[model samples]
Target chain A: MENKRNSQTIAEYIKNWSRKHSLFIMAYGTGCGAIEIPATLTSRYDAERLGIRGAATPRQADVLLITGYLATKTLKRVIRVYEQMQDPKYVIAFGSCTINGGMYYDSYNTINVLEKYIPVDVYINGCMPRPEAVIAGFQQLQDKIARGEADNGTRYKENLEWYRANQHRVIKNWRMPDYNW
Target chain B: MAREKETTLYIGPQHPGITGNMMVKVKVQGDTITNASVHVGYLHRAFEKLIERRNWLQSFTILCRFCVPEPDPMELTYARAVEEIEGREVPERAKYIRTMVMEMARLQSFMLWYGGQSGSSGLYTLGQWSVGDRNYLLDLFEDLTGGRIYHMYIWPGGVRRDLPKGFKDKALKTMDYIEKRLDEYDKLLFDNVIFQKRAQGVGIIPSDKAIEWGVVGAPLRGCGIKADVRIDEPYEAYDKADFIVPTFEGGDIWARAQVRRIEARQSISIIRQMLDKMPEGEVYNKVPNPMKWKIPAGEAWAKTESVRGEVGFYVVSDGSEYPRRVHVKGAAYTNGVTVTEKILVGQNIADVSFILNSMGVCPPEIER
Candidate 1:
């Protein structure tokens, strides 16, 4: 029993280590903050050195970087994209808009609290955070993964009903496919 | 040999190749697009409605968000509109500073376009090089204004502050560096055969139909017509500066690219002239307190030539602290929607994003 437990811990450590190193951010420029992503990933900041690269489709992406203020229209798509991302996925909410709707806090279209609908592992607060801040946020996420504390995906599954209620409240049409997970 | 059935393909509100949060629904027959329509509002923040609630002075903060890549021009247009409504004369020195800032904005925005255009065409090197070099310009903006992206430096009466110490020399040096780099870009991008073949014949907009469709700025000039807000209206210190409005004849992506390339060079020269002819005086004319400031009951429209095209702001005041209404007439509204859909039809499926970039279809400006 002791030998089996020790091997399981080693396997868990290996899995977390690999996951922490490769974070494929979905290349969905949802809002204004999308502009900074190129700056962060490109030559000057070079986010690739830290193992953060853009994944073209949601199915392949491991991280959903919600760039900025999401209108109710975009929130539906964001939920769809988040659900499509594979398991062990993480979210880094960028800008104050994602945190508390930033300058658009009172705007009728944008939601104030992003966490109400989706679980966020990190929040980088700025009207639009600089590339340095974005890189730092990724580092924080990497650290969380290393410590095995970045399990918001499981939390999302556990409270899927509550999250769906929040999503449904904003997205009135409710045309999305049912979550089977 | 049966006729291929047309299929509908949705390009994005989330796709990478797209400029921003907007979608294009295209009907394709085999590899060629037969019909196209643009769907916007993904990035809409109800800017016009929000501006109505804020007082005259406070509304400047929100104006800059209309266009993400270039915010200075939005501020300039709104400031010009407010100044017109109240008949507030900006200081001579402030006019020159405003002109310089606008030119700087044009340069950086064109840099972004260079990346977008080249990236869309599979030339990833230019995107990397241009966006990386764009940091120098962003550094200049950060030094002048407190923020990198959103610079609320231009206000109703005048600028927020005078040029900082050693700013002129630093700006001149940056210009020199950029001018040198533009040659390298020419060799790398303009001279390359693949880019030439891809851009030369694609996305053609005839000169006769361009004005009717409300195409303005570089894309208009690309159609062989000579029209520019700076040359035609001569706002700010543009009257004081000597520069020619560059025009090209192809009416295609290549012509638009060439128009921008020469305009970037012209902008550099214009900035140099503004610095040379700049008068020493106060940079700002202080308006009344923000909470109590009210404009006389009137309306005004102001226009400025941004990198994309002519960006105009119309402001209506009701003799109250808040504006009665605010409406933005951005070039993207016409180009991104009507012109984009019109041009995308009959083009190869691969060139949708390519043509969109060449037209400078900024989505936030469209939705805002």
Candidate 2:
């Protein structure tokens, strides 16, 4: 009887939460892993089941999923896009690419690690993990959401050590990116 | 037009005109580009680093993400690189199969390019017909490789499976369908005078500049510089297959489009030849289990004539279960950003997308 009552209250809590927040995803699929994001979010995967849809712009996104690696050429844009996302945004690093430079680790123009640059809440492993795995990641994010764990505001604003270490391998002569702006 | 004394316009990373995850910061005076810096990494997966961490076979699946448009070239290059290290000889039949698959991939990619190249100039029909027509090829890919987009079928020793029963016949029929559709494309795209006017004199890359710019594939060939991996260094069954490296001297978007059109024809011819001359033998030579496959320590550079220019995989192995280094040279670095910026300097804003489309700059290649 208590179990039923608890479940009903939890359902009510979820309903209130859904009405208050519409999850916006930065459906950023960087590599072959990206091909599956569309499949999962469309009718097949129905990311809408969790009230998530791909946002047209980063500023509108509630979550930024780094689906693949962070290369030098793409890093600037990644940073820019991450910045454009609203304050309460959560970053989901979708594949091995986002965790560590999965490949292209030694290229002169590429960055080997992603975690150093962005604060990732979820790391889904797979060179290009399957759509099923992607759905699982989404479910996990939803669980985090159910707990009402909103953005910390401190994590990204204050974190620079990880980003600096990952970029140390690149950035010849250790010239820091202009941060005064 | 020179309004702002010093202005910076960020062109991508979130721009609709550019495909995939990439950004080009272009400083323009009025409409003409003054200075440009190509920024990449939005899609960089540190592929070389990742491949080093994974076993040889696992890397195969990872390789496809390098060039989304023509991923097979990367897969083929990685497999051949491993073969070079292990000294594994692919069966003659497997070679023929590889040749067949490569040409088909080339055809589909070319078709997609044709649409993009034309669609940029407001010719939407070409994009519609070709992209939809491409579904036929994707269907075949799905049936044989189990994945429509990334078919991790080609491996070190050989392909994953022999052509499925009736797969060859179906492929031939698809070829026929594509051939029939090409005329419609020709009429709607290349044969149209507006296309000629819009593409002919735009984005000229002279033969002298071609080599200096490090251009490859169709764009370089379009300038009359004869450089094709298939001719310069034949891999798989390219040596046995009879086809010409199509070239044009126009040195503009028209030339690039023309070279691709002619090359598509060459790809079709090669596909027919491979099917006709396909030898009877096992498609796959058994290799160590993927879970335990360890490559001997060595470094080698493998290049393939992808739909894009010279796609290379420079791999280093340290006699371990995984590669020590695997750096993929996606054509985007040179063709996608560097060259596009150089040529886009004097071009109008309207022609930017058109010229980029003609260059076939798949963004993931740049991002990777």
Candidate 3:
């Protein structure tokens, strides 16, 4: 029992340390907030200094930064992207649209409250949050991961039935493959 | 070995080369494209339908989203359309400021173009340099309008606020800095042999088919046309300033890039002229209270020369607070879709995003 417990502690420490050091973001800019992303990632803000970088593909990404409002069509693609990402994944829902859909709340297309369909680990508030706010949000996510409080990816797996039901209801066409992983 | 078959590939909704969230489906045989289709609707938020629901003043907020990189043109076009419908007269100082803002947006957008075009071709240093330099303009915008990307500064009657003290000095200093940077950029990007070798004669848009395909902005200008809304239909303070509409003979990627580079220089000169001749007057002419405001029934079309090309807005207002219909005719509408499909045929698969970048195709505008 002591040996098993020690192994678990070592695993936790390594996981937390690695998670805090590197964050590969698949910045899906579905709205106006996408414009601020290049500013944050590039030399001016230098998100690389904090070990945050952009991943070209979802397969290699750690965090899915849903930049702004997600239209129904984009929401389908976002789900596919999220499912493709590896385990220990995170979702950083940016802007007011992800919270309650902001100005696009009444729009027929965009989904209100992204957390209903996906487990959002952090929410960055703004009409379109500035680069400073984005950096802060990343900091918060890093802190959460270090504390091992960032277990939403596991939560997603446990509540897979609920998340899938909600996702299927919104995405009408439902052409994508099943998220079994 | 007897027969060559075409294979299909999808480049997008998350592709690095693509500026935003649209996909391009290409059928290729041995690295050469045979047929192409642009799969948009990834970033479509139904802006037209959404605008119909919001009131006149409120609709301005969403206009900028039509094109992310250069948003002031969207704001200006929408504002001008409403102003014309209302027969509102803008103050002289406001006109000059609007002109300066538009020119600033043009300069910053060209910088963004440099980053995207170079970044796609494995020359990431240019992307790093240009995007880093673009922050200077963003800082100016943040100080002036309080938003870096979405500057909701322009309104129907006039701009939201007047220039702050020492705004001109700061703007001139930035302009001077940008001028020096432009020369360095020409050496780094425009004059590079590798870029020239890759861009020259690639993704050629035939001059004869330019009009039929509805190509506008740099793509059209790259085909040796002097067609510019600022010259043809001068709005704001464009008529007040003297500037040339730069054009090139070849309609390839290099030619388009050249057109953009020359236009960036012209924008600098225009901004200088605008600042020097700007009159001292009221910045804004306030409209009615937002909750109770109403616009009379009228239809108006306003077009402005955005960094991309001609950005036109056709707004129909009913005798109510909300618009009857707001149709944004973005330059990228035809460029990103029809022209992209037509031009991608028989070209190299690697140059897909290069061509798209050259055309200044903003995917959100295409989808919206």
Candidate 4:
């Protein structure tokens, strides 16, 4: 029994280590912050060197990097995308707009707080954070994944009702699929 | 002949190949698009309504957000409109600085276009190279103004500050490096067989229907028309600079690409002349306290030739610190919506994004 438990702990450690290295980011450029993302992913910043590459679809992506502000209409799509991703997923919200609405605080269509609607593992603060800051935010997430502290995906699944309430308040017409995950 | 069944396909609001957060709903029959329609407003922050509440000075901050890739033209147009309404004079040196800044913006915006156009067509190498090289221009912008993406330097009456120490030499050096790299890009991208094959006869905008559809900028020039706001109605220091407005016969993606290629060189030449001819003087003619500033009840329209096309600001003042109404006429408003929807019909579904990028469809500009 003791030997079996030891092998299971080793398997868990290996899983966490591999997950920390490879992050397929679904970069949803929701606002002005989207412009900075190309710089981060391209040759100058070379985010791929750190194993952070862009995924074309939500099912394949390990990380959802929300570039900036989300309008009510976009928020509905974002929630759908987030739910479509598989287990052990993470989210990195870029720009101050995602934190507290930034300059678009008073805009009627945009939401002030993003965390209330979706679980975020890291938040990079700026009007639009520079490429270096974006890389740093990814590194922070990498650290969290390695230490097994990043479990927002599970938290989201557990508190689906509360998130659905916040999402429904902003989105007037809710035609989303039921959250089975 | 038997007909294939029709099917509906939605491209974006999240697709990787799309220029920004906008959607294209296309009806296809056996891989050929029969009809297409553009759906925008994903990136809209309601900038026009937000501008209504801010004071005159505060409005400049949000103007840059109207079009993310090219923001300088928005600032220039708004400043020019306000200056015209107040009948304020911009110093000679300030004029030169503003002209130089706008040209730099045009160059950087073209770099982004090179990336987007090629990337959507499956040439990822060009996107990587051009976008990486674009950082040098961003570095120059960071030095002159405190910001990279949104400069907000151009203000009513004049610019916010003078050239930083040794800025001219730095800018000239960067321009030289970019010019040298343009040749390498020509070999890698413009001369490649696949790119030519994909771009040559696709997404054709017939010359006869170009103006009728409200096309402007490189896409219009690509239709063999010589319509440029700089030449027809010279603003700022453009009257002093000499440059050619390049035009091409074919209205396909290749023609637009050629128009932008030659135009980028002309921009470098114009920037060189503006730097050489720049005079020494105060950069700004200070206005009254910004919070309490007011102009006579009047309206003015000012336009600038941005990389995408003509970006105009129509400002109406109520003789108060706030503007009564501000309407923006962005090139994408016409080209991205009506022009794109009309052109995409009958084209292959594979070329949807390729055609969209060539027209310079910026979504924020469309929705804002």
Query: In terms of lDDT, which candidate is strongest?
Result: 4
- TM-score of chain B, per candidate? 0.98, 0.96, 0.98, 0.98
| Model 1 CA deviation exceeding 4 Å by range | A1-8, B1-4
lDDT of 4 by residue, A1-181 (tens): 3343244476677887788889999957788888988888898999999998988999999999888889888998899889999888999998888999988899998988999999999999986688999999999998888777789889998998899889889999998777666
How much is B222 displaced in model 4, in angstroms?
0.6
> Candidate 1, overall lDDT?
0.90
Model 4: docking quality category: medium
Residue by residue across B224-256, what tens digits does model 2's lDDT show? 988999989999999999999988897899999
What DockQ does predicted model 1 obtain? 0.76
Task: Single out the weakest 10-residue window by summed lDDT for candidate 4 chain B.
Answer: B1-10
- What DockQ values do the models have? 0.76, 0.20, 0.64, 0.70
> What digit string (tens of lDDT, one per residue) describes model 1 on residues B1-368?
97547898888976878998899999999989999999998888999999998898777778888899999999999999999999998999999999999999999998898889766888888888888888889899989998888889999888998888999999999999989988888888899998899889899998899999999888999999999999899999999999999899989999999999999999999999999999999989999888999889999999999988999989999999999999899989888899999999899989999999999989889988
Find the candidate with the highest DockQ and give its number: 1
RMSD of each: 2.9, 6.0, 2.9, 3.1
| DockQ winner between candidates 2 and 4 | 4
Native contact recovery (fnat) for each candidate is: 0.70, 0.31, 0.63, 0.63
What are the per-residue Cα lDDT tens digits for candidate 4 across B1-368?
76536898888888887898999999998899998999987887888999999988899989998899999999999999999999999999999999999999999999999889767988888889899999999999999998989999999989999999999999999999999988888888888998899999999999999999999999999999999999989999999999999999999999999999999999999999999999999999999999999988899999999998998999999999999899999989888999999999989999999999999999989988
